[model samples]
Target: MTAPVSDHYSAPRRSALAATVVALVASVTGCAGTRAPGDEPAPTGQALVIGASLELTGQGSALGTQQEHALRILAAKLDVDGVPVGRTRRPVRLELRDNQSDPTLAARQAGELAGDEGIQALVGGTLPETALALEGVARKRKIPFLSLAPGAAVTGSPDDEGYVFKLTPDDADVARRLAEAVAAQKLRRVAVLAAQGSHGDAGAEALPTALKAAGVRLDRTGRLPATGSDFRAAVRRVATGRPDAVLVWATAPDSGAAAKELRRSGYRGAILFDSGAVAEQTLRGTEASAVEGAYAVHPMSLNGSTLTSIAGSALARRDFMYRYLQEYGEYHGFAPYAADALELVAAAARLADSLDRGRIRAFLETQVVEGMAGWYAFSPSRHGGMEADSLAVFVVSQGAWTRIS
Candidate 1:
């Protein structure tokens, strides 16, 4: 059921839905295409259905729940009238399932969703393992998968990953940004405390090269136990060298727990985090004081733009933030990745003029949009969409993430 990869890229023949912020930007000239008069009929009412398998009730619930909220809010907004499809404006619909942070469950749910003829595309996977599991199913079914997880290997090679797309910035990008930040502070030595999974595996592998490039030395590295497990011993091991800083490469609440353990071990050096640690859970209750001064490399969407800018993307982001805060009472900066994913899929549907999985896959490769989260430039040669320029540094200050870079 795999989709055939196109050798040549085609320009999008029409503008994407206005609500999705798909306006052509200056960087991508000649991307907008025109349709011949009377080539297509008038708008027909239908629905663009998307499927999701998230970690709603398990270890990754903190991030997964935020994504769920984002998806719901975006769906409601787009459905106000509908998103522009070929000759029709289609309402967006979601079929969401809880994977419980289990890779096996995620794969099964992906299979079921992909099997449904009504489900046009898939999005979810807040954890690296779950995202990888979903990748397997999406590849087998030849369905387009937009992964919200942080992992370099999630999309592997574009040739083999014709149907898979990563919404998060690459691990190497985050590592490089973090390394440069550490170097800016003149920190010579750093220790790493990574989580026990694929996400941590990526950080562990990328940090050494990035640190070396930034003239920083790697002191030591240790692995944190699974969620709910004690982190004192692991933290103590990495803190033995009295390194100038420690990088906590794991998602919350693990990110916060590791910080707590580091503080308990009497290590007062700087604590750096990858984007996965930007969740609200990292700064809640006991974890707040521990992570108060910690820094993280995340997307610029976290800081958000003021309405004064008046850019379409800025306006779209401001609207999304307003809706998210109004509905959920608070905003988790990381949640917009899901909204971006859904919008990417809708944009593809608009360009392809069809809901066929193969067409969606092809158009998805050609997308270059300013999403709610950040800028994504997908091409036939690149499936990991989030650009490195989209990343920025933020610090946990006053119990909130405040942009510092």
Candidate 2:
């Protein structure tokens, strides 16, 4: 299957990089500044740099591309002067490095960002493994790291996760929701197909726990390469099980392949996918009937509801979505999450009234803000920053994703 022409996210433009960096400084008013312990003072005459390591040209590019794009968009719409710290605005600069889908490189770049670039905060990591790699750097450097991926590995231990935070729903939470959804429909047997990685492993581990009380049994389990091109063999094996439903936990194009293959096998009672498959564009050219009744567990809804319950109000969400469409030609599943992560950081900086990393980290632990996705609040015990209500079920009806619950 060919990628849609409009799906390609262009590289960052050099000419506007400085201007965009300057725009990222959000304004803060009426805040007193006190330097918090373990906090580093802001650099003089230089922008407050924030570094990001994203998979720019590899298997995870589908998701990372959107993350990078979202950062660029948010940088433009934030503020012109920079974030207000100590009654003065500090110019914010974004320095992005392409990890090319390698976790090692992601970690290496993160160290460089912290040691050499002097970035106060960091964002990126669409893949769970990459996030795990990035997490180490955050802990070692004590820089606030906002991960865009969903996995317990990103925010596992409070001691290890002090500097780490994520905006997306944890895979454990998503797996539970999916299991409950299956159990509600009286489906006792399920075929689980997960990709081979941290995301897949987390889902594989969480599903059974959620289904144990419901008495849903896994009839068969299969694992495929996270970025594998062919899934016919896995689909055939799953179809042979004749389970009540098939749960595919994988990233976009792979999830798309699973749906197509299952339909071709002609044994679908119900086809369900994980959060990564929620992006509507993943199944763009497929026949409506191919996945007509398919379901997905998504972190947030992008449809009809006013979204007033989320941060920034419905108007802000509307404006951001509109701008996203205008800029990218279509909305990617993770774009809003990435944008919201940046917004949350900026909001934290405003609350702290300083560019001090420790201050911002402390502020985030108790700060409650409505973001593009939904309500977000963090605590010492929870670094994932999401709750059970963070996920909702959606179904494919009439060739579109419709929120059913």
Candidate 3:
């Protein structure tokens, strides 16, 4: 069963909580709400339950764990009493289920959460396939789904994406940033190793176009199951190509394993990874030297200057980082995305001044809010919420992620 839990900010920080709540509510309602017809009234006098299905114990666990932590933090921070909706204090409950990194399980649990649990909105596993699965449930159930993963196909067109939205930037942008890195490094030829799934397929499909734009040649390409751990053969195949750089588009430990293997295979070329591959937990099994000098293209949250610019002030950014570290003990790459997803939902609820799914969805379609990761704006035709400018490239140096332009 998905755990149904509620949390609120520390009692000692009432003033801060009020301020944050005001900001969240105002950010959405300042120019929100053009409701559609045939909307139903929301339930009253009960906890507004939102559901999340996360890959908490499998290949995606490294990032999933961070996502869960962020959910918990935002659930507490934004758990306001008496929101703008008629000055009514409503307790927001987050029900989380572990999908174990399985898309089938994610889809199944998402159905249960919507059909049986009757949650108002859905958040879920950090993969494109999972996003696709949850989107189906959202469409059928007429509830909103917020994805924390990168997948361009998740929102193929505006016509099919009324209730589905994503917090991460599109895969095309990530690939373009990666291509920029290749050009910046002056590498002409590259080998590709990507996971097998929606996220990987999207990246793999976009890479060739991006590479072509950068005048880089794709010499070799290898595909691995998202759950596949063995990369000895794939690494050898890619290494033998002797490309100027090896581009790995995968998640944590798997990509880390590929990086380690690339080094062991004596491939003395540059290594570049997709954003999802560079979290701290993902690099634990691999040696630091294997990752040293390897570059990755990820969101701007990984860089202080870019993050401060989006977050509005140095002090506000510092406060969020301090709170996150204090609560979670360690930071994970997907944490900020998860926080932004939940906070955006809460803000939509406030802006609509009701818990009705139709009203909230309507508000989200025109909402613009500054999240911990970056700015998010949604419209009838745009459901992903982020722009290409949200991405930045980073290099692993001395076992830490350092931003490079």
Candidate 4:
């Protein structure tokens, strides 16, 4: 995990730091204006501002809200010890923006954040479309970006500036495992229902290949616009095809609508979903009784669940699925992914040395970060780890998502 020396550098004692307030003005937004490579801008009085964008009020609002709460728990732990393996010249401040589930808005926010003079690094985003949209801006601004989720389209084509880094295994690998899960359930006939978003498109394009390799037959496949008030028509269309299994990848687009519609139509086949669509509380509300025995494949680890179970409150990942349950009285959601994502971000920063975007990105691309999951590593040629073809399939039993792995 050693970072390349060229990528990061610590500041040496500066002449400006000899006294009190020595000011430096930076007017650029979206683009960085740094002191001469050698002229370390003596320690400033302000805390280093970390920028984040979450889909707080949009289709993906659930994840956004949970991640924000999870990050708070992480920040609280930064009291004396920073994020694990954490280091910094000053205290860190997290600044968040809401994309409200709009891809364009998410991109715009990232663009503006990159240009902002006060922000140092970028983190947080639950969708890949937004990640791709913000990719260019991160490159243009020379700011370190830790998407800390999944996707290779953006992280694969990492900028020369090495500003892009991620923390999840690639879908290509996830898709393969998902195909296996489908076959294992004896859901030999498959129908694909994709949302009109980045994640959906990727799953749609990838599933066919994965299923075909697994000797699974496809009955039908269709794409749905990411937006919809109801899914009666779409459900009817897929039902008409009589698929043995329905594979849906909703991403941040929200699949609760379609899931509910399927239930109303009395579709009883195993309804397989991408982890992105199998939201905790949202799915509970959908009442997709037809899919009561449905299965889903997600990128998760044993560590998150273990920790949350052990630590009921004080600094558990994503506020502890257990504590959230205690306070809210009936808690449910995928809190581990968000908490784990932040942990990886802080680790990458430490590995990359001085938080230099270029260096950290390079460090991530080259090093294997041992996370709650198995070893996570990335490279230009291979953007994800863990075979996508072998994701963990879980079934809903007794109102809880139970892993079949």
Candidate 5:
């Protein structure tokens, strides 16, 4: 009882319509295969797609949001400058996927994006664990991949994965910086508070060694699981011994929470927090009184001077600050690491020239681009451009981060 379908077009007309559709698809797909702007692309005329796996929702969401927007700025810059493809008359696309801070989901998202024809390279990162998963896949596929999170086990070690590149300094250097800082104060007894996971484990081990070398003792240590939201229990347990100083290795909120508990416990001694609290918001939650004298270490150039000469005058001392102001109205919420990662990835896209994975890896291995951070030079020999010794001790003053040294 179905009605007959309308067939106004004759057989010849239908054939012409089908042919035209095929031609249109061919033209679009062939866009990047050719260099000329006006010329139609080859059989596969698609733009290069760079895949990013980030924690866009969940505990790491705060950082993930900033990175998402920063990626947009990167896209705009490359499109205008015509760096690797777009500026060169061929366009490359930046594709981002949210991992929500779950390692399992991150791995699944990575697998889906790996083999797509539009995807030329991978930018999976935002955390050490996520980076580890992405690099494992990238290595097997021989695709170039970069990670922003610092993890000692990812690379450099004899049995580590060479296919991975890190933009952030690993815990090895941080341990030394912290040890030196504590040594300067001549503190003998040190209590530890660290979260569970790769960062915590690496730091837990590194700090003890560094402290031992510096002639300090790890009197007592308190460990918490990955999902432990409240830091009171661990902070209280570590407080029993009343060590000279409390060294805490954790993320932003955890740092704030621990800072609160340390103060509540009436501990008047110094507290060394993790570099993750470099963001102002992290410390803002703590009673301004709590973070007043709390100490941590960050790269010297972070708040020391503007890398204007390196990043160009267009991006003066306030390049990042200015960009954030333009978007957020109020300044300081945008994360600088995200911007740094975008710059690194764009540089790779530009220097590599071709979309081939092997060539991109080779070019990135020697990339020495000037970012907001400084001359962010990199080589296969070193994953992090910033030397570990470059740390400048700092403390919270008047609700803002100020250099201590």
Candidate 6:
């Protein structure tokens, strides 16, 4: 079932909080160092470094690049006053590496990062394969790893995922939302064109059950090529039945490519996408028109609305969006999972009063923070921190992703 939106604060309360947020944003942007009298003295300890192995120049670059931007912005912001760890406030640093979208390379990089004593926590992996690779390394090294990938298997078994946490919503939650959207539109039958990978595997596995519960029939399913070479044949196979709608469960580039191929193949039915399609590449150039009216199940952050209030999550999101716009000129509605990962790490460090890998991991399991993207409630049994209610429906309108629900 779709979750209801949370209640908004009253107008007076919102205005008061908004004023406080304005000051917070000013301090963040200005990097103000002045402290009030009687404030604790700043520490001169070494920076607390976080490591990241990302697909910066490969198939996952569409999402990885955005994450890289988020990490840089947040790292800089935190360094202004640093994060509190006990009585000391230490600066933040990021040691980033490019994994080239290869799972093998990602594993090697994760090993190298985890071996470094200065690197306390790790975050990366925009692709499921890369995330799984990193998870293996985190488990072996006993270091905390925050994964940005949507693959449910990243946290499949909590016993083995004690040191790992996922910042994205679970595949099952996304699938349920998509299925409900289809039912609401009265789309009786739907075909799924899933990409070939662990991400696709999870979606395909959970979708049938969700669609069934929503009272919608699953007409057919086809797999897009792993290399994303040619989607024409796959699109043809899935569009053959002329189902009421076609759901493309794939990441960017593939997501937009499949939409273009579907339109070219003369399939004019409604197009639906998984959260991975929220990347900038999905709506760029000709592909924008191809997916103009396509709907997607994504985090509520995709709305990217102007700041009207200053609730914790809303304020953080607004500040993040403002910083992102200053750095990149445009916000593509992608969730800042990397930013939240960094914040989560810092919060854990503060809670544990130490930077020890095991201590950070232990405290991480107890956090419940309102982050930039959404609310994350992490615990010993639940490593997939993003709340299900954070998922919402979005549609491509005028070459932009606009939240619909």
What would the TM-scores of all predictions be?
Answer: 0.89, 0.84, 0.85, 0.75, 0.80, 0.90
For model 1, the superposed segments whose C-alpha errors exceed 4 Å read: 1-43, 153-161, 306-310
List, residue by residue over 225-259, the lDDT tens digit for candidate 1: 98999999999999999999999999999999999
Candidate 6 stretches greater than 4 Å from native: 1-40, 153-161, 305-310
Indicate the residue-level lDDT of 5 in model 4: 14
Against the unseen true structure, what C-alpha lDDT does each candidate score?
Answer: 0.82, 0.71, 0.72, 0.57, 0.63, 0.82
Candidate 5, residue 30: how far the Cα is off, in Å: 26
lDDT of 6 by residue, 47-76 (tens): 789999988988999999989999998888
Candidate 1 clash pair list: none
Ranked by TM-score, the better of candidates 4 and 5 is 5
Question: What stretches of model 3 exceed 4 Å from their correct place?
Answer: 1-45, 80-82, 116-118, 153-161, 307-316
Ordering by TM-score: 6, 1, 3, 2, 5, 4
Q: In candidate 2, what are the lDDT values of residues 69-185, reduced to their tens digit?
A: 888777666544455555555665679999998999999999998786456788888888888788789898888998887777334355654788888877767777788788778
What is the full ranking by lDDT, best candidate first? 1, 6, 3, 2, 5, 4
Specify the poorest-scoring 10-residue window by lDDT in model 6. Answer: 24-33
Whichever of 4 and 6 has more TM-score, that candidate is 6
Error of model 6, residue 167, in angstroms: 0.7
**How close is each model in CA RMSD to the real structure?**
7.5, 10.0, 9.7, 11.5, 17.0, 4.6
Q: Write the per-residue lDDT of candidate 3 for residues 147-181, one digit (tens) a residue.
A: 88777734424554488888887778788888878
Per-residue lDDT value at 263 in model 6: 97
Compare candidates 5 and 6 on lDDT and give the better one: 6
The residue-by-residue lDDT of candidate 5 on 1-405, one tens digit each, is 111122334687545544542432233222322246675432322455678888777766655666676666555544442334333543546888998887788777777777775576676566667777887777766666667565673443234335566666568677777877788888889998887777678778889988898888899878865553666778889998889999988765566777788889878888987676565456565456787878876655556353223224223326556666588664432255555555555455555656666666666666554444433445666666344434567777777777666
Local distance difference test, candidate 6: 0.82
Off by over 4 Å in 2: 1-46, 153-161, 286-289, 304-311
Cα TM-score of candidate 3: 0.85
